[model samples]
Target: MVKPATAADGRWDADPLLGLVAGCYVAAAVAPPVVFAGDAGLSLAAGGLYGLLLGTVLAVTAVVWVAVARARSLVVRLGRSRARWLLAVAPVGYALGGFALLGQTGIAGVLAFFAGLGAALLGIALAAMAHTRYVAATVDEASVEWDGRTGWPERARRRWRRGAWVVIGVTAVGFAVGVLTDRWWLRVAAQALFAGGVGFAQTGQERRYVCTEAGVEQRLPVARRLFGWATFDGYTRTDEAFVLHRPWRTDLRFAVADIDDPEVLADVLRRHLD
Candidate 1:
């Protein structure tokens, strides 16, 4: 039986369940095309079957992860469980339309397209998981620091380079595939999904970052191939920081910090401007 979380425990106790659900959703989102790839015809029955399988996997994985978290004392079980019904209901989530797409392709082509879609979804799901892990680690550790050196610059540079590589690689592969197959539609679809995933992942990474002791030096692609730094404007007394421009192309409130060396950091930022 699921237990209720105590007042003292609050929302934090339920985080593990949320994580489990997220993981399952990711799995459900990615699995159908994988299974349908083996066969070329799609039907409602086939989709339902896949949905059931995917949902069960997600529910089971969630349960197991929760159990592990409990074992490790990472989360305390609430006497009242909100997720019990979710386990039972989640299996049908995949049926919402994974197999339905097959109808658009006339069963046979549906089978092929579904296969492609599922494959693409699988890649996206994996990327989501990786991103979640990174975010969770950063939040839990509170380890992000602005060491006020060239570290921020170097890291930013790397991030920009990595993003560029992803965009370029995906585009290049899509172009090559298009050329070889002479199928503009297939190439376009493939590149759309692949390149879009790369863009999303890189963007997410850029959104959450800290400037290490290294100088702030990252290049970002804008409307053109322009690159720039995460310029700092100054700081407010309330521990809020101001930067002339948002780094990583994200809009965020200032990062709050009460460092021992605000003056030096300010000077460094000013120097970069000059």
Candidate 2:
């Protein structure tokens, strides 16, 4: 679960001013394509009415994007197959309504838009739901012994060192792409990748994780988190991931390679939860 933060401190992932501008930018980007691609019968000659309609469309887009961006989960988990199907129905409903209203230029274009839109909205809604349902059981956060300041586990240290170099190489490729394509966005993405690589490298060199009897304390450039057995509803270990299940939401994921000692960690978790 995400730790709650107040707006007073500069702890937000996104800057408010920039986020607002980004929302508006997204609104503008999305509306024109839809309106221009629509039927010939749709008129924009009435200046006042057209402006009002366009504004409304922009407003809706901004709201949806901002809401989804601020939403809790990046993906959704409905817990069961049948429930998932039920979630899909809402998007289908959106498509139907869109078809009824915007299908003037034949069913094809309308169907494409509505279908894509419905799917996107459904995914966003599910993620939001997962975020909402996510919870961490109560535990003694204070008095938690943390040896993280010493160093990362030896295995994790090696992995982090390797991963950082790989990421930096990727960032270089991204930089090259941006230069070749003359795309600012590409450069921005490259910058983000570089920053992440730096963070990873620093994590390896800095104080490591806090491993305790209760759970593991994960430290990042952004925040410190403790995931304890007291909250473990279930767990699934796979080749790629170590998933810890708590209540309500889907499983929490950690890279399998990132763990200190997988066998020992698994045993401790099993013992405590049992």
Candidate 3:
């Protein structure tokens, strides 16, 4: 559950401006795409009209976004902001599924697929920023303690790290096979394998933190593990980043790099300590 920040808690990951932009995205996704193909016949003029209509809709969406951001609470505002991106991503999935069902495979299909992919990627980037703000605000630096108990699940997770390397090794083999075979299906499978391998490799690193934060917790596999918990003191807010802090914790900064609501995290830490 996310912790709620009181008025006293420092604002973290709060982006009223971004929230407005995100709201516009949500509106755009919900609105109908301009329809140029009709009984009147599709022409350059019709296409131009379609574009003009779409642009107008987008402009209206922007206005609505601003209104919504101004009206909602910070947490609600952030949630709506993220929802906008998620809404934007839905179209990509729809396009992919539709094209696959239509048996459309070729340069055109690939181009269309990639176009959707690009939009999806952009949405993901926005969502990631929102997520960072959310986590930073909700998870306090102090709450993440290194007591001494190593639970069974944690041990199991640690043991699973061994499999991560194996997965990576297998992925490499698949990639080689796919390239040699020159089969389209094989190529896709190989890429999937490689991606999965990378995922597992990262998971293996995460396991390092699973070793209960007891005395001398295990260090990350290498010095370059970038996603470890930072002391609250290390966190800072920027115009681009979500900033959260608590007035009571003067010694620590407890800022999360890219959360949507740092206030929630601060509140969580505060309650846990109290």
The global Cα lDDT (0 to 1) of model 3 is 0.44
Which digits, one per residue and each the tens of the lDDT, describe model 2 over residues 1-274? 3345335323234334423433443443344345544424454444643574467566865575566446423212331123534443455445445556664544334543455454644444443333223322212356344342434445656876798989999998999999999997689679868977886776534434555664666555533355555667777777765566778753455555665566765665576655
User: For each candidate, what is the lDDT?
Assistant: 0.43, 0.52, 0.44
**Which model scores highest in TM-score?**
3
lDDT against true structure, model 2: 0.52
For residues 156-197, could you state the per-residue lDDT of candidate 3 as single tens digits? 345555676677677677777878877666666666677766
Model 2 root-mean-square deviation: 11.2
The number of residue pairs in model 3 that clash at the backbone is 24
Candidate 1 vs 3: which has more TM-score: 3
Each prediction's number of clashing residue pairs: 19, 0, 24
- When 2 and 3 are scored with lDDT, the better candidate is 2
Q: For model 1, what is the error of residue 204's alpha carbon versus the real structure, in angstroms, after optimal superposition?
A: 12
